[model samples]
Target: MVVIEQEPEEPTRPSSPAAEEQAAAAAGGEAVRPSSSAAPEEAAAAAASGEASRAAEEEEEAFEDALTDEQLREKARSQANDAKAEGNKLFGAGQYEEALSQYEMALQIAAELESSEDIRAACHSNRAVCFLKLGKHDETIKECTKALELNPTYLKALLRRAEAHEKLEHYDEAIADMKKAIEVDPSNQQATRSLFRLEPLAAEKREKMKEEMIAKLKDLGNSVLGRFGMSVDNFKAVKDPNTGSYSVQFQK
Candidate 1:
């Protein structure tokens, strides 16, 4: 997710003394300059407005004082890439926690710099990889989701999310992500292989879910029928495989 600071509300644009006096005259009150020491509310409002402007100026200056827009963008991208590179190094060294911190730093810098969408997406994907390594499957899914929001065609994010789904046994989601990955990169052998492998597994999960649903319906039916001194077991459907038909039968 893109990070942002909540800005202080803009106090009503400061009214000029002439405008304030005109409003006072219209309201049948004596026009008087609001003394800062005597009118606490007016003073507070003015103070708040000034503070808001100053804060905005400081924030703008912080970005503008150092570099031009193009230069700032370049700096942000470079800094983000550096952090990502360091994170990769830590990940390769099997320091998952440290890697995660570096990836997070990359994300923060990218946000502060307002880096490109690709940079944000890459940072998010790298963070997801760290989560995956740490066995935080759900967290990995969340990070991948953010990355995909930034760049839906991000192949690494797609695969990472798919793997996280697989870990959580969300077979339908895993298969869907893998299918999308394959669509994006038709020649991706790993995606193709995963799709082939997970298809049956997903199908099996679906079959199992169907059986559970059927069993639940049966139980509900039995409960209702029991109230009438009957049960679902009293009736049966005998399939005629040859004719692809079923014959209803009743137990005596």
Candidate 2:
């Protein structure tokens, strides 16, 4: 099962002309001296423009520098939440790729927010859902693992990761993840059902693997024995039921 989180609406930041002007000024680099052929009025206007641009840049920089750490963090959280909310909307619209990009943006912004682990984890989990929808099972597992790293008890991440593992035929890993999810939320029927379903699959896979290994070993034994005019059929492996151990016996 895949789960996406919807972030609460946060206050939007007001557009600042100063910030836009600062960007334009930076991009312009060294201001071009009003063409030497320009009029006196034009030169004066250019000079005024440069001074205004510098004043805006200084003002913006000062405003940024004056922000306390907590305020800065709050701003980052709001920005991250905005990105996450956009991703959720894109996901709901069935645009998984676009949603993935927004989640990536959220993660990048939230990465340095020490108190925003929940946001980080939710973004990662949302990205995992995108991957899952896109049939990128490996990427889904990676994203879910990242979410789980940030919040180990994240049930959605565990369940989504288990689903990814199952898609890749990694029954044991799927079962383990489902078990962890169940541990994290004992009342989760989904996890309990998943665990029940995965257990048989894991057991079947293990048995199949064991049988394949035994067959390969037999082939190897036969190859070596053939050189001595013998076959693997000349030996028997008997199991001691009490100790669950095997005993190799020579046979005619």
Alpha-carbon TM-score of each model against the true structure: 0.66, 0.70
Among all windows of 10 consecutive residues in model 2, the one with the lowest summed lDDT is 26-35
lDDT of each: 0.85, 0.88
The regions of model 1 sitting more than 4 angstroms off are 1-70, 237-252
lDDT of 2 by residue, 101-195 (tens): 99999989998888788999999999999999999999999999999989999999999999999999999999899889888999999989988
Writing each residue's lDDT as its tens digit, candidate 1 over 1-252 gives: 223688955434337986765666646855445545647888899789888888988888887866687787787788888998999999999998999898888888888765367778988998899899899999999999999999999999999999999999998899999999989999999999988888899888977886697678779989998998988788876778899555757885
Q: In angstroms, what RMSD does candidate 1 have relative to the true structure?
A: 18.2
**How many backbone clashes are present in model 2?**
0
Q: What is the lDDT of candidate 1?
A: 0.85
Model 2 ranges with Cα > 4 A deviation: 1-69, 242-247
The per-residue C-alpha lDDT of model 1 at residue 98 equals 93
